[model samples]
Target: MLQVRLLGCFALEQSQRDQSAVLGRNGRRLAAYLFAYPNRSHRRDKLIDLFWTESAPDQGRTAFSTALWKIKRTIGASGRQMALHAVGQNVVLEIAKPAIVDAHRFASDIEVALSASCADSIRPAIELYSGAFLEEFDGDWVLEERERLEVLYVRALTLMMRQAANQSRYEDALCCARRILATDPMRESAQRATMLLYTLNGQRGQAIRQFERCRATLREECGVDPMPETRSLDLMIRSGAVFERIPTLLNETFGTGG
Candidate 1:
């Protein structure tokens, strides 16, 4: 039996026993959307509207039907069984039991990692996050899911960095912080974390340089100064008090580190 799972930012296929194939972009998209909204039946008109919004109405309908037929042909008998019922205007795909999807699994694992008491338990979960949800699909239907996944991605990385810091793994924390900042240069939490990691590891000069680069980027791009909290962090570094009161400084900065 083929197990198809979908949750949040992860999607996985188990039991490669079935060699089902979905050919072409539009055909693949139809299958993917149907799989994603398994509980809901979609109207033929609605599917046409979504995928061929820019095409002429008659042409769009023709295209939609062609794609649907392709999906049916690709999955063969399993495809026909998966098709619950298609009345004159609506078609529904049905599963006998709950489907397993990688997106859903990834979300579940991320939630557990977020709530875990130990960082070690969360490490493997973080590693499971391969990439954004449905990286291949760029339709309007997928945008919201992508954004939601991105936020979770950032939060997971942040949690890992904090865990490393708690264990005095400054180098590891620095690497995590840098990765976050690369994705979001304006992420103050990551910037502050990097600064703190540098300071803790006796790389005060590098820490100060990080601040300088951030200041330049913010000024050139946003025409704004760094937040007072980040400025204060730089001050702490200059005064040689960063290591002595690292936690206190982090608490004060809150959201202005990167």
Candidate 2:
């Protein structure tokens, strides 16, 4: 079984072996392109265009062939057992193990955890999402996939924050909320969660600071003010009438204090 780790950096490992050989820079990029877009085979011309954009047509094709050969060699593919192979004029990465990609597993795990009843189920999924996809790689596909994975990570953090807040784990909740806000400053729900947790943790000033941050974010980004729910929370916090509340979209009643 072959495994490709794309979350932090690029690492290709065979199940039986302890590690993968060092792939050349172009070789790594070629392999990553195939892994990133796995559903369909890519035409030889397209692969050349994507990776060797600066070279002449013939030179680009040669460069792509070189990278593909290196990728195959690095993954231990041979004449009969080809990991990256040509199907007609198009090439495809036909690895034996479908679950060899960490990004795929991370996505599947998060999907399961989202609908799961047990909070514990989500822990592994959250842990699997170590960082942005292809953290060191810079390309159009890498940027898009990185954004997608980062969105997933943020959702996991939001869910953890809500779970912790429901369990009265104020500190943990605040930690998660802060993490979410750090990733996306315009995340109003996380801003509100941080404020509520700050008040509950006996730091009313910090709670106010969170609200101010939210207000500024909203004004700058959307050219709008905080919603009624946010203002209501503001009044409650300022007047020392703090209760167990959180950000919500539809209704004013997020939750009643227990």
Candidate 3:
């Protein structure tokens, strides 16, 4: 099966073997743009305007043709296999299907996981996500997709952390929560989860430190304070509330008390 993975960057293939040749920066940008807008056909002129915005109209068209040729050469397309089709003064490139792109796969997995009732069934699918859809690409066209995928990634990570906590894998839960917090420090659920994990591990000072750091980050970067829930948790930890309740709560909740 052919896959055109776009995880870290653009890659093309026939079957599992990659047929993608090393493209220069411009060619890579073109490929990234097309992969990002696979469903919609883009006009050659629009692409020229987007990438070669500094060039004159005629020069832009020339540059666009050069980019298209480079892509074709790199992907081993012959003749009209990857040619610009005229469409009312606008030329569009036709992208073929059954293509395995990372963003597509990530979206598919997210949909499946959302539909599935059993969290266990979605674990493997969630694990398939290594990073953001196209972590390196930061073009204006891709920002919306990037934000969407980031939300999905955080939710998947939260689910995984919850599952780990349920399984008494406090260490694993802590690690996953830390990762989520690193990406979005304002994610109160992840922060709460990390605090819970620290309390479970008897790292009271560390738990307090986590809360303090979260508070500092939010204030410094976002000009906001931590949520009431987080502040309450901080107060609880400082007043020995968490430690005092740990034995009974752990026994009743997880059925394992240390």
Candidate 4:
């Protein structure tokens, strides 16, 4: 079985060995495109338009043909049944046996986790998101799907964080919160969550410092102050007030809930 990894980096592995070198860079991109839309027939002309636009029409056609042929040859040499097929005017990726596409599996696992009540069910999906979708590749075609998967990744992390906090696992919850902030420093809700978690973990100084960082980030990026709720939280913490779980506050604020 061919394992296609479209998350983080682009790789095609078979029998636990890397086969990406067989396709080279451009060949890998072409193959990755087909796997990104697996089992779907993509018109050859459309592919030429997408990948060979920089060349003259004749040159583009020749390049497209060469790329497609290379893809076919590489897959054929894998010692497995054909994974690429030419049907009528379109090309299709139809692995004879099951293939593991990380993007597909991530979506499927996350979908199942979303519908389940058990928080632990989300772990598998979270672990599958190794990094941004196709982190090494970029184009107009990749943006929407990349953003979509990133949103799912952040959502999964947030769910895990809240569940851990609810269970009084401050350290674990803080880890998730920090990851969220790392992915998106502009996320004030995650910043707030981090602050709260730090205080809960008996690190009041770090909590105050987190607030200062949030205030600085918002001011620098948006030229604005922290939201009122965040400001209030900062004040309470600075005044040495007793802390409590303010998940409700996070939910009602101008950003995603903690």
Clashes of each: 16, 0, 0, 0
How well does candidate 3 match the true structure in TM-score terms?
Answer: 0.79
> Candidate 2, overall lDDT?
0.74
Best by lDDT: 4
Per-residue accuracy of model 3 over 1-258 as CA lDDT, tens digit each: 435666655566665555555555666777777766664667676777788888889888877777776665655543333433546545455555413566777767776786664556656766666666567767767678777877877777767676777777889878778878877888876786687789877788898899988898889989999998778778988898877776554444334553
Candidate 4 wrong stretches, greater than 4 Å: 15-17, 77-82, 96-99, 242-258
lDDT of 2 by residue, 1-258 (tens): 566788887777675552434556666777877887775788998777777788999888777777777777776643333366776779987754445688888887887887774557767877776667888789888999999988887877877776777777889888888878877887666676677789878899999988988998899899999887778788889987665433432122224233
Local error of candidate 2 at 72, Å?
0.8
Colliding pairs, model 2? none
Each prediction's whole-model lDDT (CA): 0.69, 0.74, 0.69, 0.78
Task: Give a tens-digit lDDT track for model 4, residues 1-258.
Answer: 667789989887777787777676666778778878877789988887877767889998777777777777756765654567776779988755433788888987887787774569888778888888888887876878888888887888888888888777889999898888877888888887888778778999999999999999989999999888788888877886634535554454323355
Ranking by lDDT: 4, 2, 3, 1
User: After superposition, which runs of candidate 3 have C-alpha atoms over 4 Å from their true positions?
Assistant: 1-3, 11-22, 77-99, 243-258
Q: Sort by TM-score, best first.
A: 4, 2, 3, 1
Best by TM-score: 4
Model 4: colliding residue pairs: none
TM-score per candidate, chains pooled:
0.75, 0.79, 0.79, 0.87
Summing lDDT over every window of 10 consecutive residues in candidate 4, give the lowest-scoring window: 249-258
TM accuracy, model 1 = 0.75
